[model samples]
Target: MPTLRQQLFRIKPVPRQKEDVETDLKRTIGLFSLTMVGVGSTIGTGIFFILSESVPVAGPAVIWSFVIAGAVAGLAVICYAELAGSVPVSGSSYSYAYATLGELPAMGVAACLLLEYGVAGAAVAVGWSQYVNQLLFNLFGFQIPHALAYAPEEGGIVNLPAILLLAMCCFLLVRGTGESIVVNAIMVCLKIGVLIFFICVGVTGWDSNNFADFAPFGISGVVAGSGLIFFSYVGMDAVATAGDETKNPKKTMPRALIAALIIVTSVYVLVAVAALSAQPWEKFDGQTAGLSAILENIVGSQWPGTVVAAGAVISIFSVTLVSIYGQSRILFTMAGDGMMPKLFREVNPRTLTPVKGTIVVSAVIAVLAGFIPLNFLAEMTSIGTLVAFVVVSLAVIILRVREPNLERGFKVPFYPVLPVVSIIGCFWIISSLQIITIVVFIIWTAFILGLYFIFGRKSSVLGKQLAEAGPTNPESARTDSTGGAK
Candidate 1:
């Protein structure tokens, strides 16, 4: 029998069993729809209000913050592309760590992803409530009462709209991935069009003065702003999360990731610049519905604002849906690996989807969205995503060193250097976050690790597989060892 240290550090083989894989998730996502998933998830609610958070710090140079954050995201995603091509699994960074780092590390990555997807779903839903009310009042001159529309911290009883949004998303997800992708694609197009409308109209009122105070806080300010704006880039990894369901994930995953990054980054930069040129960066401080407000101020009318609000309502629903979709799949992957309960891995025959997982995920996030204030959720998400990115970058380097001959459809350019820079960039942004956010993240991760010690280590499926294979079956046992390439 292997010692405790060896068992904890054992790796899951890259090769999967036929029975283990054949009847699980279906491969219905193509490159285009996968790209739409990434775009839909990333561009939500952030652009609608991010300027208010980032602009005061960096002034007009908040534009550079967008680029910096995008660069970090792109580098990390490139690493993800390489790993997704190599592993082609569903757990995103978690599975990558299991294949390269070890079981304990994989669980660590899972801790971060739970925050990234599950909490982010709730957080994004909470933001969606505001836009839903805005759209309602804009169209019908009626709005959900504050008591029903906000969490207690926001001076409301419960965020009913957020819970309602989560319910709608859960219903669609339980139906099937194909249908969800189609709806998300439509929303992506509609929201992109709305942003373009804002850009075209806002540029008409361009004032040169906005650029005068550019870099008012210098590079330090730009970096700080990048840290804040990093939240917008969180969803790109959701594309990689679809590896198991993606058609030709090796090619499709990388193509969709790069395409989504280009599209999201371009849209973010253009919107930031247009909004900046139309008004002084100083005015962005404490602004709500930043994009819609900018359009209204530029055009001297409420109609453009109304149009943006409606688009936000439609677009943010897609974000919440994709977030919930991602959370369920990650849980499904974990359950399949025996890290979570089997109910999460149970597929519904009618839909070939993890129906129970989706419902459970939606219910948990619904409670959070309804009862918790999301004022800190954005920062928490950024930290979680950044930490996960750091691990992906490390996994790329480790896999390259260990599996030198392993086949990869996509490889990170500049090899180890790019991955290292990606790690450094992630840490650079991480250091700029509030001390309290970092402390809270550490506490949350500790709590998860505690669970791992209590239950996961005892029940791990990979550990059991290795133990049953034993020393007598040398080939199978070797295949299960850490950093072992097949």
Candidate 2:
């Protein structure tokens, strides 16, 4: 019997006719489009809503949280850049892990990514509804019934607007990738426009007294807030995942990744500063539509809030669409690897998209949006993403030592130190989360492992291929049309 380590490290032969797999993704997305996708997906709901939750924990120290989260995210992106350039596959971390770490670890990473991408998408959808309702109330002097706006336990039967937004995104995704990109770019501009407006108007109302209670809960609070706000930085990895689609990925990938990170971090910091200057951190808690609230305070009129609200509603919808797009693509890659059901891998000939998987994901998200509250869902997303980021950071170290002679398009600048810091930073943020988050995370991991051992270990295409051909038979190894292993 093979040892666990052997099974875990067993690399599968690349599929024959690899050209087919390589050509699956249309190479139409460029650096500019990729950057816009990253910005559009990263900036919306987290900045609009999470500040309210995070500020209560860290007071004005939330700014440091933004800094810390951005730094850690930057390190992880550097590592991700190397892996993405090397693999040039569509699975994101899942494919990279499979190539270097083996099948089982890849499946585990897939589960974590499901949470990071799918659940996060749903959580953002819920937040979009909150902003939409706020906009309606501000513009028309009418509010959606509280029952239709919130999830149960918050005294609502279901979040109708959230469900509607999610459904619309699914339809858009099914149409085609080109449409998705155009819509994402438009949404990105709208969001940035509103944020610029907020900054300009908010700065005028700045009161230095709000900074008086900075760090009210001390350094620990800052670390805790960093953990909560880390989700805002999650979309930066989207840039790295476009490795196969980019032109001259070795050069293009790093430029786009670093550029996106800098842009996202700067926007986050500016927003935090403007928010802090506008009001005391204590007042941030429970303030839905945070920028709109700032606008209301600044202009002393409902019009500015209405404008901010409309912008937020449009932007959040786009964020949800991009996030769901990422999730569906990740699942498709896993399915193609034979780690998940083949159904997920099936692409509609007409659309060239993962239709079944997208539908299933949309269904689950709709159910969650209809039932679960946003706060709990957001924490769950943060925990999953932090865990996945740590895994990717560690994988970078393992790949460097194991495949030292392999050609890498991009290398992490500081080597072991940056990755080590990334791991530590991710762990610190994970620790700051609530005990319930830890518990739920443990349960989720356990369930994933259980599924892997039961189904993945036995039926994994890689394992079956290895058993048939033996590890040393280069002749038996599969080759794609491009003469590359899948």
Each model's RMSD to truth, in Å? 2.6, 2.9
* Model 1, runs deviating above 4 Å: 16-23, 472-474, 477-486
| Candidate 1 overall lDDT versus native | 0.86
Q: Which lDDT tens digits does candidate 2 get at residues 201-314?
A: 888888999998889999989988887788788776666555445555655666667777888899888889998998888898888777777888778888888887888788
lDDT of each: 0.86, 0.76
Residues 233-309 of candidate 1 have per-residue lDDT tens digits of: 88888987887788877778888888999999999999999999998998999998888888888778889989999
TM-score of decoy 2: 0.91
| Candidate 2 weakest lDDT stretch, 10 residues | 12-21
Give the candidate number with the greatest TM-score: 1
In candidate 1, where is summed lDDT lowest over 10 consecutive residues? 477-486
